[model samples]
Target: MQTDAANPSLKKTLGAWHLWGIAVGLVISGEYFGWSYGWATAGTLGFFITTVIVALMYTSFIFSFTELTTAIPHAGGPFAYARRAFGPSGGFVAGAATLVEFVFAPPAIAMAIGAYLNVQFPELNPKTAAVGAYLLFMTLNILGVQLAATFELFVTVLAIFELLVFIGVVSPGFSLANFSAGGWAGSDTFGLPAFTGIIAAIPFAIWFFLAIEGAAMAAEEAKDPKRTIPVAYIAGILTLVVLAFGVMIFAGAAGDWTKLSNINDPLPQAMKFIVGENSGWLHMLVWIGLFGLIASFHGIIMGYSRQIYAQARAGYLPPSLAKINPSFRTPHRAIIAGGVVGIAAIYSDELITFGGQTLTANIVTMSVFGAIVMYIMSMASLFKLRRSEPALARPFKAPLYPLFPGLALAIAVLCLLTMVYFNPQVASLFLGFMLLGYAYFWLTHKQREAAPDDALLQTARSLVD
Candidate 1:
C-alpha cells in the first residue's frame, strides 16, 4: 500500500509572494500599532533604541526559523521538527505553545479594533465593537485559506501605502530638538520613573515582531516549499522592519514625545497635527489601517488551526482534530476546535482582578512566555538537525551557522528569563499549562509507541534528498 507520506492531502496553492503576504498579514498589525503607541509613552529616543533592539532579536528568530524550515519542510512546522528530534511529547508541548499564542492574540486584536473604532466614533462601547469584529473575522476564516491570504495581501498593501503617506506628510515637520531630549536610559530629563518604565516595556516592544516566522509555518502548503518558503520568510521580515522604523521616525517628527504618550491613535494624531483638523483624507487613511486589524485576526486563525491539525495527525492531539473535510480539503475539524477554544479565551479575559489587572493581561503575558519557550526549542532544533542530518538538502542555510543559531538561543533564553522575573503571575500560569501538557503526554505515550514508525521515518528522510 502507498504510504500517507507519499500522498499528503494539503494542496500547494501559495507562491513566494503569497506566503510573504501571510506572514506580513499576521505580524505587522494589531499589537505593533499598540507598541508604537507604547513608545510614545517612553519618549522618542527610548522608543527608537528599544525598537531597534527588539527588531534585532526578531531577526535572530527569523534566522532560527529559516534553518529549521529548510531542514524540515513539513506541514506542522515546529511541532513536526520537535517530534522528529525529541519525541511525541516534545511535539505536544510545541503545539500547545503555538495554540497559546493564537488563542490569546485574536481577542487582543479585537480589543485594538474596538479601541480604534471608539476613536472614530466616540459614543460606541469598545467591548461591543471588539466582539462584533471578532465574529466577522471568524466567519471569514471559515470560508477558506485562499480568502484569508487574499484579504491579507490587500490589507498589507493598504497598510504600506497609508504608512508611506503618513511618513511623507509628517517628515517635513521634523524637529531634531525633540529626537534626543529624553535619551535611551531615560536620563535626568524624564527621571527614574521613565527608566523603569522602559524596562517594563520590553515585552510589549518584542510583541510587535511576534509572528515573523508565520510564513514558514505554512511551508508545506506553499507551491514550491524549498524556494518559496525562504523567500517569503526573509522578505516578510524586511518589509515589517522597514515599516516599523518609518512609523517611529514620522511620529517623532510630527509631535513631541510627551504628546505621543497621551495619544492611543498615533497615526491619526500625527496626521491631524500635520494637516490640521479639517483633513478628511487623513481620517480615511486611519480608517483603512484599522481594517488591517481585522485581516490580521483572520490570518492568525488560519495559521493556528493548521498547527493544531498537524499535531493531531501525529497523535499528540485527539485524532478527531486530524480529520480533513473532503469537499474543502481543509482541516475543518481542527478549525472548529480552535475557534471554540478561542471563544473560551475571550470570555475568560472578561473576568477581573482586585489590583486593576484583568484576565486579558494575564493571558497576554502567558502567551508571550510560551512564545519565548517555543523560540528556544525551535532554535535548538536547528542545531540538532545540523549534527543529525548534515546531508539534508538545504536550499538556504542560515548565515554564520552555529554563531547565529547560538546567538538566537541566548537571546530567546534572556527574554524568557526576563518574562519570568518581571511577572511571576503569568510565569506561574505558563508553568501550570506546561505541567498539564506533560501529564497528557504521559497518558498518551502508549498510543504513540504502538503507532507505526515507517511513515514518520519516511517523512524525515525525505529532507535528506
Candidate 2:
C-alpha cells in the first residue's frame, strides 16, 4: 500500500525568492557574529586563509548538493538522501547530524540576538532576551511557512542592506597596517603553531556559511522545488561568499582587528571603532543588526522543525512530532520541541564552557562539528546515488563530476578530524549525542517497518518530474 508519507502536510507556498531568502537568511547571522571567534584562534590573516579554504569547500559542496536537493526535494534534506543511499543506519547518522546542526545553531543565534538588544538597553539581561526570542520566533514558524518566509525575506533584505552600509562606513577607517600587524597569528613568521591555529579556526570560518544548506529542508514547501531550488542554492551561495569576505575583511581593517576578536556583536563594535560609539551610524548598526540575528534565528527554527517532522514521519523520531497543526498546516509540535531545547541551551550560557570559550563559541563549534559530519554524508550520498540510480532525474547537476563532490568530501573529512583533535570536550559532547540517538534509533526502529523504498522513490520521482 502506498503511504501518504510522500505527500507531506506542508503547504507549497514558497517560491524561488522565498527559498533564496531561507537559504541566505538561514546563514546571515554569521556575518554579524560568531565568525569573530575564528580571529581569536587564528589571528586575522590566518583566519582569513582559513575562511578562504572553508568557502571553497562550501562552494563545491553547494554545487554538488543541489543535484540531490532537486532530485529528491524531501523535507528531510540530507537525511533523506543518505537514507536512500545507505539505508536506515546511514539515514540515522545524517539525520542526527542535521538535528545537531539545526538545533544547536539557534541557541547561539539567540544569544547573539540578546547581545545585540543589550546594546540598546544594558539593563536587559541578554539571557532573558534570548529566551524571549525563542518564544516569539517559534510562534511565528508555527503560524505558517508563507508568513514565515515572507518575514524572512523582508528581514534578510534589510540585513543585507545594513551590511553594505556598515562596509561603506568602515571603509574610511580601513587601515592596512592595523590589519597586517599580527596577521599571522601574532607572529612575524608562520610556524606549526600558526598552522594548528588555522586548523582550530576551521569551525569558526565554517560559521560564515554554516546553515545555507538548511534551505533544502523547505523543498517540500516550495513551488516546483526541482526548478526553484537550483536557482536558490546557486544564487544563495554566491551571495553569501561575497558577503562573507566583505564583512570579514572590512570589519578587520576598520580598527585593530585584535579588538574585534572574541566578541559576539563585532559589527557594531567595528563600526564604533570607525564612527565612534556616539555616532548615529553605530546606533543604527546596534538596532538594525538585530534583523540579521533574527533572520537566522527565525529561519533556523523553521528548518529544525521540518527536520523533526520528516524524521518522525519516517519513523526515525517520535511519531507524535510528525503531527501538523490542522489550522496552520505547520509542524507545531515539532517547532515547540526544538524551541524547548534551544531555550535550555540559552539558559545554560556561561554555565557551560569549554577550554576558556564562551557559550556562544562552544555551541558554535558543536554546530560546526555537526555540519561537517552532515556534509561528509551528503557528498557520499551524492556519489552513491549517481552510481546506484543513474536514471534518477536530476534537474541540476554538479558542474564538476568527481572534482566538486570529491573536494567537498575530502575537506569535510579533514575538518572533522581537525575539530576532534582540537576540541576534545565539545567533540565528546557531539559524539555522546550521536551515540544516544543511535542507541534509541536502533532499539525502537526495528519495531516498525519504514515506508517501502519503491513507494518513496515513486513519490520522489512524482514530485521531481
Candidate 3:
C-alpha cells in the first residue's frame, strides 16, 4: 500500500536489462542449476516431462505476477498488491509468506554451496562451508543492493558460460542407450509404491522450478517499472525454461540416467566422465558456476529484502525494517533482517535433525509451501485489484486477461494439493505457519486501520510524480 518515507530517497536507476539480468541470474542459479540435480533420479525423460510441466507452471505464474506488478509497480510484489486489494490484513499474510520464502532461500543456497564445496574439498565440514558462504553473502548484501546486483551480474555471466561449456563438452559423449536403459515410468531406487513414488517426486520437480516470481520483487527498482518488469518477468522465465530443458536433454545423452541419478552434483560428475579426469580446466569452470549459484542467492536476498521493506512501510511489519541507508539509498535494515534469518537458518541446519533428516529438508519443505501460498495470493490479488480498481492504469496487461491468471491459479493449487497429498507432515507444518500469519494479521488489523492514511498517499504520490 505504501513505500516507506524512510526509503523515499531510494532511487530507481536499474534499467530493464539490469532487472532482467538479476531475474535470470536468480532463477537460473537458484532453481535451474542449484536444485535441478534432484530431478536426475527421475531420469532424462522423467526430468524432461517434469521440467515441461514445471516450466509451464512457472511461465503462467510469471504472467499473473506481471499483471500485478504492472498495476501496482511498488516495492513489495505480492505484499503491496495484496494490500491494495484486500487491505492490511491480506497484505500481512502475503508479506509474511514472501518473507518466509526469502528468508529460507539464502540458507538453501548456502547448503547447496556447501554441497558443491564437498566436490572440491571432500574432507571439509559442510557446516563450515555453509557458514562461510552465509557470511560472505551477508556482507555483500549489507554493503548495498547495487553492489550485490553488480556482483550478481558478473557471476551470472560466468555461470551461464560454465553451463554452456558443460553442455558442449558433454554433448559429444551422450549415449541415448543410457537414457532408455531404465524404464521411464518406474524405478526401484525410489523404494515407495509405484503411485507413491511418482507422488514423492513432485517436491523435487517443484523445487527445480521455483523462484520465477523473483522478478516481480524488483519491479519498483526498475528504471521503467511498467515496461521493464513485465518483459523481464516473461523473458527470465523463457530463458530458464530453455536452459533447463537443454541441460536435461544433454545430461540424458551424456551418461546412464541411472548412474547420473545417484550423483548429487550431476554436472561436474558428468563432465569428469565425458571430458576425462585430466580436464582440470573444466572442473574449475564448474566451480565457477557454483559461485554463480552463490550469486543467485545474493539476488534473491536483494529482491526479498525490498519486498520486506515495502511491507514494513505499508504497516504490515515493524516500521523499523523500513529504514534506508542514506548513502546506499536502499532498505539497509530490511536487508540485514533478511541476512539474519539466513544466518539463523544455517545454524539450524547445522544443529537440528528430524526423523534423520537435516534442516535443509525442513527449510525446503516449508519454502515450497510458502512460495505456493504467496503465488496463490498474488493471483487472487490480480482478480481483486481488477474488481477494486478497474480504472488502475496497467502498462503491461497479461495476454488473454483472466485466462492467464486463472490458469496460473489452477496450476498453483494443483502444486499445493500434490505437495500436501504426497507429504502431509510438511504440508501440515506449512499450513500451520499460514494460519499463524493470518492470526497475526487479525490481531494487527485494527492497529493498521487506525494508522494515518497520509503516508500511503505520500508514498503513492512520490512514485507517480
Candidate 4:
C-alpha cells in the first residue's frame, strides 16, 4: 500500500481561509444561475419546496462527508474513501463519477460565460468565447498554484459582493404576486405530475450545492488537513446555504420566476423585474455576473486538474497526466488535458440535442447525475469506515454518527432515482461513461505501479536533474 509520500511533491500553500474561498468559489455560480430551471418544471412555489428538501440533504451530507475527508485527507476525495472501504472497483466508480461531475461542469459554465458575453457584444460567437475562456484560465493555472488560488479568492469575493448588491438592489421590488403568478406552469394541482416535477427538480436544486464537496479534493494542498478541512467545510456550506436561499427567494419574488426559468442568464433576466430590461443596472449586473461564472469556472478547473493528477499519479490514468511542471511545480499537463476535454464538450453540445434538452441544461443534468452518485458513494464510505476502521483518527467526527450518513444515503438514492426517471437520456450518457471508464480500469489494473500519487513524478524529477 502507498503512504503519504504524495505530500512531498505538491506544495502546501492553502489554509482554512483559502479552503473556504475555494469551497464557495466552486459553487457560487449556482447562486446566480441553474437553479432557475427548477421553475420551469415545478413552478416557483414547488421549486422552493424542492430547494428546502435539497438543502436539508446537503446539510446532512456535508456534515457526514467531512468525517471521511478529514480522516483520509486524499486528493482523490470520495474516490480514496470509497477505495479504502470497497476496493478498486469502488474507487474507479467514485473517481469516474467525480470526473463526470467536475470535468463536465466547466463546459456548461463556459457556455454560460459565453452567453453572458453575448449579451455585451451580440456579434461575438459564443463558441469562440468559450474556447477562449478555457485557454485563458488554463494558462493562468499552469503558471502557478498560488497565483491561481489568489485569483480564485479575488473573483469569489467579488462575485459574493455582487450577489449581495443584486439582492439589495432588487429587494424592494420583490412581490408575492409576481412569485405566484406562474407558480404552477405545467401541473394543474399538487398531483402526480406536480410530485414528479418536484422530484425531477432535484438536479436543478442540487446544482445549488453541487461540487461543494470539491473542497475535499484540495485536501492534498491544504495547510492543515484535520483543522482546515473541517473549518472550511462547515463555513463553506453555511455560506452557500445563505446565498442559495437568498438568491432563489429574492430572485423569484423580484420577477416572474417562470420568465427566467430556462434562460442561460437568470440574474440579468431577474433584474428586469426590478429595473427595466434596458436599465443601466441590468447592464452592470451582466458585467459583474461574468465574475460569478469565472469564479466557478476557474475554481472547478483547479479541482478537475487536481483530481486527474491525483488519480493518474496513483496509476488510475496515464503517467503523462501526472507529470508536473518543474518551473511552476503545478500540474500543467493535467490542466491542459482537462481544458481540451471541456472545449470538446462545448462543441459536442452545440452539435447535438439529447432528449429535447438544450445543450446547457443537458450538460447540467449530466453533472448532477455524477454528483448524486458521488453523494451516495461518499455517504456509504463514511458509514462503512466508521464501523470497519474504528481507530481511524478522526479529528472531526460527524454529529449524529450513523444517522446522518444513513439519511444522506437514503435521500441521495431517492434523488438519483428521481433524476434517472425524468432525464433518462442524460442518465444513460452518464452511466455509459462510467461503464467505459471502468472497463478500461479493469483491463489495466494489473499493470499499475505500486506507488503513491507522486512517485512517478519523483522518478521524472530525478531523471530531469
Identify the candidate with maximal lDDT: 2
Give candidate 4's whole-model lDDT: 0.84
TM-score of every candidate? 0.88, 0.96, 0.88, 0.94
The collision pairs in model 1 are none
Give the alpha carbon lDDT tens digit for every residue of 311-353 in model 1. 7776677767767665455677777777676666656654422
Query: In order, what lDDT does every prediction score?
Result: 0.69, 0.90, 0.69, 0.84
What's model 3's TM-score? 0.88
Please say which candidate is ahead in lDDT: 3 or 4.
4
Q: What's the number of clashes in each of the models?
A: 0, 0, 3, 0
Ranking of all candidate structures by their TM-score, best first: 2, 4, 3, 1
* Quality of model 1 by C-alpha lDDT: 0.69
Q: What does each candidate score in C-alpha RMSD? A: 3.5, 2.4, 3.6, 4.4
**Model 2 Cα lDDT, one tens digit per residue, 1-465:** 222554347788999999999999999999999999889889888898899999999999999999999889888999999998998899999999999999999999999999998999999999899999999999999888899999999999999999999999999988878777687763433545478788889999999999999999998889998889999999999999999999999999888878889889999999988888799999999888899999999999999999998888788888788888877889999999999998888777554586889889999999998999999999999999999888888988999799999999999999999999999999999999999998989888653375334323555666443
Clashes of 2: 0
Q: Can you tell me which runs of candidate 1 are displaced by over 4 Å?
A: 1-8, 30-32, 37-43, 179-198, 259-264, 276-278, 349-363, 447-458
- Tell me, by TM-score, which candidate is best: 2
Q: Where in model 4 is the C-alpha error above 4 Å?
A: 1-8, 185-193, 350-352, 449-465
Quantify how close model 1 is to the true structure by its C-alpha RMSD in Å: 3.5
Name the lDDT value of residue 84 in candidate 3: 72
